[model samples]
Target: MNDYLKNGLFLAAGVAIGALGAVALGKGKFSIRPAMADLLSHGMDLKEKTATVLERAKENLDDLMAEAKHAKESREGKSVAEGETA
Candidate 1:
């Protein structure tokens, strides 16, 4: 086929597809506002839940770190006492 003919055919196909899509969309009562609002609402809820989970994890990690530090200090104290006896 000729290049010009191929280009024309593609252009016609694109127009036909666009026209059909527009007609289909026009026939439906598809409101994007409500869909977007619902999505944002869910996103906010997820954000809140994630923040809560992260906060709890931070608290648990802090407690674990404190306990580890105290354990290390206790071990050091025991080693010093043993050294003094020797």
Candidate 2:
């Protein structure tokens, strides 16, 4: 019985708020379009920043891999020369 009463009150409150929002929207006193646009603008900015950071990270990784490969080849060539001399 107590739970039912609580649920009923919550439902009533929701209906009241919905009705008020509808009235406000009908009168053009409140708008969600501008807010949505701002949200989307921020989202776009974040996406661009993330893409740039990822590209930079990929370039850095490529440079490190090239350096490592060169170091390995140099070591192998030195060992082969030393073996030939022996």
Best by lDDT: 2
**Candidate 2 wrong stretches, greater than 4 Å:** 1-30
RMSD of each: 13.2, 10.9
lDDT of 2: 0.93
Q: Which pairs of residues clash in candidate 1, taking residues 3 or more apart in a chain or in different chains?
A: none
Best candidate according to TM-score: 1
Assess every candidate by TM-score.
0.64, 0.62
lDDT of all predictions, in order shown? 0.92, 0.93
lDDT of 2 by residue, 1-86 (tens): 69999999999999998898678778996687787699889999999999999999999999999999999999999999999999
Candidate 1 per-residue lDDT, tens place, 1-86, comes to 99999999999999998798687678886655676689889999999999999999999999999999999999999999999999
Q: How much does candidate 1 score in TM-score?
A: 0.64
Go through the candidates in order and give the clash count of each.
Answer: 0, 0
